[model samples]
Target: MSETKFKDIANQITSRIEQGIYAAGAKLPPHRELANELGTTPATVSKAYKLLAELGRVESFVGRGTFVRDKSALNQVIQPQHQELDFNFSILQPCLVLNLNALTEAYTQAAETLSPTLLAYADDSGHSAHRAAGAIWLQKHGLQSASSENVLLTNGAQHALSLLVETLTEPGDTIAVEALTYPGILAIANLAGREVVGVNLDDDGLCPKHLRKVIKQHSPKLVICIPSHQNPTGITMSVSRRQAIADVIKASSTYLVEDDIYAFLNNTPIPAISDLLPQQSIYITSLSKAVSPAMRCGYIKAPDALLPVLAAHIRANIWLASPINFAAATGLIEQGTAFELASAQLREAEYRQTVAADILKDFYETASGFHIWLKLPEHWRVDRLVEEAKKRAILVSHGGYFSVGDTPNCVRLSLMSISSRDRFEEGLIQFAELLASKPMPFSDFLN
Candidate 1:
C-alpha cells in the first residue's frame, strides 16, 4: 500500500508526463533505472510504460527506450466528440465493411431504371416499381397479404416506425415495448411524443402474464415487439408466446407493431404475429439487415385501412422513400442477388462469433446475432471493463448502454464491423487478458 511500489511509481510517472513534467516527445528513464529510483521491480515499471504506450500517449522504440509522443494529435484517436451508444453486437450497421464493388454495380444498374419523369411529386406512397418490388420482398418473408396497397416504402425502417407512431397515436398516449428494446425505436416513440412503457420478458420473450398486466394497467394504444430474434437479447418468441401475445392484444384491443428488422436471417421462419391480428398489427421490415444499411429502404405492411394514414404521414414527413435506393434493393431481391450477398455476410458474421467465443469461451455465452453478449467477471464491472479494453486500443460496448432496470454486468461485442478477422481475434484476446487482470484500487494508487 506504500507509494514506493512499482504500480505507484507507474502512476507517478504517468502523472508527471500528463502534467508536462516529462515534455512531449521526451525520453523517460530506462526501465531498470526507473525501477531502482522508484524502489520497485523493473517488470512493474515496464508494465506501466506498456500501458502508456498502448494508449498512444507514449511510444516505444525496439532496443531503444520509451518516450512520450506528441499529445496534440491525441484527441482524435484517443477521444471522440459526441459518442453514440455503440455495441459490439451490431455487425450489420449504418455501414459495416461494405463491399463497394458489389454495391456500386448494383446501384449503377438500378440508376438506369429510374425514369426522370418519376422524380417530381410522383406516387405519394412510393414509386410504383419500388412498391411492387417491396411487396415481393415482403411476401418472401411469410407476409401473405403484401399487395401494393398494404405496403408503404419509407426512407428506412426508422422512418416507417416514426410515421406509424405519429399516425396511430397522439401526444401522451401510452406505447408498450420490450423491456430491453432497440434504442432507435425508443427514440421514435419519444419524438412522436408518446409515453413508452416496458413489458417484462422471459427467455422466449414478452411473457403473457406481464403483457396482460401492463395492457390492463396502462391500456396502451400500441405494443411494439421484435418477435423473431429480438435485438440486444437475441431471443425469439416461441409459437405459444406469440399466440398468447396475440390473444391478449386482441382481448385488450391493443394494436401490435412488429419491428422485424432481422427476421430474414432467421433459419426457421415463424409466422409473423401479424398473421393472427392482421387487422391490428403493423408489420415493418427492412433491407438494412438483409442487404446493406446504406440502401436505406424499408417497408411497412399495415392493415389496409391504415394505409392512407401511414401514407399521409409519409407524404408530410418524407414525401417518398428514395426511388434509386428502392430500385437497387428491388433489383437485388428480384434477381436473387440480395439473398446471395446476405448469405455470404451472415457466414462471415458466424465465423467471427465462433472465433470470439473460442478465444473467450470462459468469459460468457455467444448469441446467434452478429455480436456476443458477455458477462464480465466479479471484479470487472461494465464501465471498468470498457476502460481496460480502451487502454489496449480496442473498442467494445458496455452493458449499461442497453439495460434500463438494474444494469446487468454484461457487454455486447460487435464482431462484424472490424475489417480483419485476425485483428478482431487479437482484440478478443486482449479483452480476455483484460478480464483476467486483477483490479487496482484507486485509493491505494492515488495516495
Candidate 2:
C-alpha cells in the first residue's frame, strides 16, 4: 500500500505501454488481477491507474476497464489551453475566420473568370499576368523599380527563400543572419548545407558594426533580414539603420535577402533595404500574413540577371506555384481587396498592440506587430517559464526556439493567434501574474 509500490507499478505499466506490450486502445488488466499479479492491493493498482491516466497514458470508462489512450488523442487532450486563451504561434485566426465569406466570394469570382490556359502548365516564373500583378503589389510595398520582368511568383516567402538559397549559394557557402532571426531561415539553411553566421542585433535591428565583423570574419555569400516589423522582436529598423546596413552590404560580397513578410502589418511607410541596394538585394513579400495563407501567393523581386536562374530553380523545385492560387491573389490585388483586408488587419493589430501595452505596461514594451518579445526577469529561466505557462494553459514560445547561439532569458508572446480581444487580455493578465510570482523551486517540477 506504500506510495513507492504504486509508483513502481505505474512506471512498469508505462514501460510496457512504450514497449508496445500494451498497444494504444488496448485495455489494461482488471485492477484486482493486476494487483494480484504484482503482489499489491487493488487500491494500490487503482492508484497506479490514476497516475497513468494523469500522465495521459490511459483513460478509464464508466462501465468498462481502463484502456491505453492513443498517443495523438492523448496529445490533443494534454495540449495547453487557457480556459480558451491560447497564445501559441502567430496565426491570423481572427482575420481568417472573420473574412472567410469575403475570401470565398473573391475566390469564386476569380475562379469563374479563370482562363483555360491557366489549366495547363504555366511559365516557371508564373503567368505573365500574375507576374505583372505581383509587380504592382511589390511597388505598393515601396519597391519602386519592381517590374514584371524581375518579379518571380512563389507559393510563399518560404518557397522564395528556398529558391534563393538553392540558386545563390553552393552547399558549403556561408550565410549571415540576425542573431535571433526567423527559425524558418535557420531550418532552410541547415537543410541546404549552408553555414549560418549569426550577426548581433541591437534595438533598431541588425547592428551594422557586428554585421561588418561577421562579413569580415565569415565572408558570407548572403544575408537574410526582416527589416519592417522583424519577427519575434517586432523591431523595425530605422531609416538611418537601414542605410548603414545597406552601406555595409554594399561593401561586402554578401547579397541581401530582404524578408519583408510583415511589411503590410506596418501602419507607416518604411523603405525596404532593397530600395537602397536593389541590385544587391532580393526582396520577398507574400499575402500569407496580410491576406490569407491559404492563397499561397508570394512575390520575389530580384535582379534581372538572376531572373532566369530563379525561374529554373523554381521549375526544378515545384515546377510552378499553383496558377489558380496566383489568379485568386492577383484578382484580390488588382481589385484592391487585398489592400482593404490588409488595412483592416493592420488596424486590428494596432488595437491589439495597444491592449497588450496597457496590460504589460510596467513589465514589457512591444511595437505594433503580430507578436511581442518579452524580456523575463533574470531569476526566471525561459524553459521554466514556458513550462509553468503551459501548466496554466497559456502557450508561448521560448527564446531558445529562435536563438542562433546562446538562448536569451526571454519569450515571445504572439497576439494574433487568439481571436477574441477580451480573451487575449485575459491571457496577458494571467501571463503577467505568472511573471510577477516568485520562481518555483526546481524540485516542484519533478515527477
Candidate 3:
C-alpha cells in the first residue's frame, strides 16, 4: 500500500471527526467496510485507523470496533501528572511546612488595625504603613538606607519585573543579563519585545569586564542581575565584583534591576548593588520565597525619581498590589514573624545543602538556596541524563532552561521541593549513580 494513500485516508477521517460528522463515542466504520467503500485494501485502512488512534481522535478495542474519543477526555489523559518529587523546576516548598500560627495571628490583627483601609482601594504605591514595613524588610537583608516613601508594593518579584521592564524600557530596547540567569527575566523580556544581551560570568558571578564590553556594545538601557545566590548557577557576587558592576553601571547610561529574591537565604549579609548605586538601581525582593508565596507580596525600592512612574505603571497594570496581601506581609514583618521564618528556612536549606554535598561528592556546590548546579562529566550528555532521570521517576532541570545563549552541559537540582529529607537524599544518590554509569548504545536498544 502506498504511504500517501494511507495518509490521505487518515486526513479524510480526521477532517470528518473535526467537522462533527463522526460524533464522539460513535464507532468508526469497520476497516474492511471502509476499505471496500473507498476501493482500498483493508491493510491501508488499518494503517489510517492507527494514525487516528495516535492522534487521539479514535480509540481501538479488541472486540469492540474503533470509536471516536471525546477531545476533552483525551486532553485530560494526555496531560502531565503532578508528582511530589518532580524537580524539573525549583520552588520553596519548605514554606509549606512552616508554622502558620504567626501568619494567622498577624492576619487577624491586620484585619482589625487596617480596618476600613483594607476594604478600599489602596495607594497605588502602597499604604504608608505597609511601605514602612517593606522598608524594614529590605533593611533586614542589608539595604540599610531603604525608606518607606521610595518603596512600592508588587504582587511578587515576577510582577515587579514585568512592571519594571514596561516602565524603564521601550520596545526593542536592549537589556543586559548574566550569560546564565533566571529564565523568568528572559521570558519577560521576550514578551515585552525587548532584546537581552548575555554577559559572561566567572566564579565571583557576573564578570565586570564582559559586562563593560556588553554595555559598550549593546548600550542596553537596563541590566538585570541576581547578585546574591543567583538562580541555576548559585554563585553569589563577591563585594569586589558587586562594586565593579556598580561602577560600570554608574558610568554607563544603563540602569540596574537587582533581583534580590535569594538574598534573605544568605547565611551572611551581602551588600546589594542598590547599596552601592541607589540612584542607578531598582531593587526588588519578595516574601514569596522566604515567607509564603500565598501572600503574593513583593517590594521594590527604586530611586525617588522613578517612584511616580513606577506608581503609574502599578496603577495601570494591576490597580494596586492586593491590599490584603500587603496587610498580611506588613503584619508579619512588624511582628517579626517574617524574620523568624526566614532564619528557619535558611537553616533548613543549609541542612539540605549538606545532604546534597555528601551525596554528590563534590560534583556540585549546594548553596543556601533551593537549588544546586551539577557539573556533568566530560562525556556525559545533559539531555540524556535528564531523560534517564525521568525514566527512573526523578525529574530535574537541564542547564538549557536557564541559558541565555548556549545551553551548558549541566543540570540544576532543587533541594527543598521534596518535603521528605530522606527521599530527597535518595533522589540525589540516584542521580549520582546515573552520572557514574555509561549511556547505553543504540545497538543495545535494538537488541
Cα TM-score per model: 0.77, 0.80, 0.79
Q: Write the per-residue lDDT of candidate 2 for residues 148-191, one digit (tens) a residue.
A: 88899998887888889989999999999898877778778877
lDDT of candidate 2 at residue 237, scale 0 to 100: 89
Over the stretch 184-208, how does candidate 1's per-residue lDDT look in tens digits? 6666665567887789989889888
Worst 10 residues of 2 by lDDT: 71-80
Summarize candidate 3's per-residue lDDT along 1-447 as a digit string, tens digits: 664787789878866875668855789999999999999999989888876665445789999999987532312211232775453323434444664777787778877776676778877577898899999999889787788888999999989998999999999999999888877787788768898788998999999999999988999989999988788788988888899999999998889999999888877788888989989999999998787777889999999899999999899888888888788888888878889988988888888888888878847654557778888987676656666677777777656657776557787776776666777777788888888888765224223
CA deviation > 4 Å runs, candidate 1: 1-98, 443-447
Task: Estimate the TM-score for candidate 3.
Answer: 0.79
Q: Against the unseen true structure, what C-alpha lDDT does each candidate score?
A: 0.72, 0.80, 0.79
Runs with alpha carbons beyond 4 Å of true place in candidate 3: 1-81, 85-89, 92-95, 99-101, 111-114, 442-447
How far out, in Å, is residue 178 in model 1? 0.9
